[model samples]
Target: MRDSFDLIGIVMPSLLQGATVTLQVAAQAGLLGLVVALVVGSLRTTENRLLRFPLTVYVEFFRGTSAFVQLYWAYFALPMIGVRLDPLQAGILVLALNVGAYGSEVVRGALTAIPRGQLEACRALGIPTWVAYVKVLIPQAMQRVVLPMGNLAIDLLKGTSLLSAIAVTELAFAARQTVSAFGNPMLIFGLVLLMYLVLAAPIAAGARYLNDRTKRYVA
Candidate 1:
């Protein structure tokens, strides 16, 4: 019992620090991913084939590839071609782009799911295409996408653990370091899981809150 307590005492602080980094990576990546999703997903829906073609390729490429390989490519390969990023930067970029690809699908699906009648009504009323998207399609789509976005947010949060591979010192990395020194994999990893759960709770709650707020709009 005393040994367990001692392990907790030694490990908790390091884990907390790692959790902080994890949150930072997740937050930045989530925000960037939202932007990418909105832009790429929205553009891919456009009537202009010139515009849509490239964006379609982007969405497909990111969505189809393995995120783990993408991370290694971003961190290890990009530098060879003169596009170099620090470990944290690469981790955030890869995660944002990966989740952004997935999020874009959510955005596209939500937007496309809006009834054709509403769009026809907008056109009949002489609403510009952009205005229609902004005032009509997007707002509805946002409400629809909120729950899925929440799930993506949690996925992004969990994905931050992969940053340990690049030595970003996020939660999993910290856990690994603790385990190496203290020789307690089960205890260390159990605590790691708990910390991840703690980190994920807020994202889940925020998603539910946003979903509730948007329910009336969706209805």
Candidate 2:
């Protein structure tokens, strides 16, 4: 009993440190993914085949492939091609690209859901296409996308665990190391599960809050 408590005390600090890395990677990747989604989504809605076609290919390729394979390629294959990325860099890049592909569809759907009349109204008012998108289209679309984006954020959070395979030293990797050292798989992994739940709960709550607020606003 006392020994178990002592073991936990020794392990907790390392786990927390790794948790910080996990959060940092997820947050950075999520932000980058949103940017990619916005760009790719907007391009996809345009009539320009030149611009849309390549973006479509990018979205499809990432969506179709396994994120684990993507991470491995970035970590291992990129170096062979003279692009050496550290574990963290490879993890973030793979995560951002993977989630961005899915989020692009969400963004495209949101933007497409806007009424054509609203765009016509903006055009009749002499609004430039860029201005119309910025002032009228994007705001409304963003409101609709909030819930989906929140879901993507949560997915990205869970996806960060995959980084452990690349030696990113994030939470799962830390837990694995602890298990190896202490030979207490149940305790270590149980704590890891609890920590993930703790991290995810607030994100889920915030998403629900935003969803409610959006509904009220729309009503």
Candidate 3:
């Protein structure tokens, strides 16, 4: 056991490097989700029947299903259908779609939360609809969503652990490797927990801070 200390030390850096993969997966998924959120949320806000109905269908589809199933579909089924991606790509793609479906609602609500009168005035002032949305509405909506989106991002980050099932060597995968090597579940999982906390705490703090300040834009 004592002799394994050197082994553990040598492995920690590799674990962290693997964790970087987890971080990259989360970041890519979250960013892609954010883009989807913007488009779907805008459509929801605009009330375009064509766009809204389809977006609604997507939201319901993802929200109704388990993320684990979605991951499996991407990893296992899509390749069979000829839309192939590596394990890492599949994990990220599924996560983005899953989270984006929910984030759209958050963004839709944030858009509605902005005072209707502001939108009215933007129209009254000859602001092009797109211009008004970009200059006035989206910023206000962003304020509301920054916190919620940050929370979602953290959830997505933690959820990356599930990727190990598909052979993605992320933080959880690294910990599992550690446990297999040393037969020390406690240490492996304990370190995993600590790493998650370390990664997520700052994002949470930033969310709280932004939430507090965003109130000023409620007008």
Residue-level lDDT tens digits of model 2 in 22-134: 99999999999989998898789999999998899999999889999999999999999899999998899999999999999998999789889988989999999999888
For residues 50-107, write the lDDT of model 3, one tens digit per residue: 8778788999999999999999988888879899899988899889998898899898
Please identify model 2 stretches exceeding 4 Å from their true place.
121-136
The 10-residue segment with the lowest total lDDT in model 1? 210-219
Q: Per-residue lDDT tens digits of candidate 1, residues 1-219?
A: 899999999989999999999989998999999999999888888899999988888889988888889999999999999998999999999999999899989988997899998888999999998998888877788788989999998889888998999999999999999999998899999989998998789889998998888777653
Off by over 4 Å in 1: 122-136
**Candidate lDDT values, in order:** 0.90, 0.90, 0.86
Candidate 3 residue-wise lDDT at 197: 95
Least accurate 10 contiguous residues by lDDT in model 3: 2-11
Q: In model 2, what is the error at residue 78, expressed in angstroms? A: 2.3
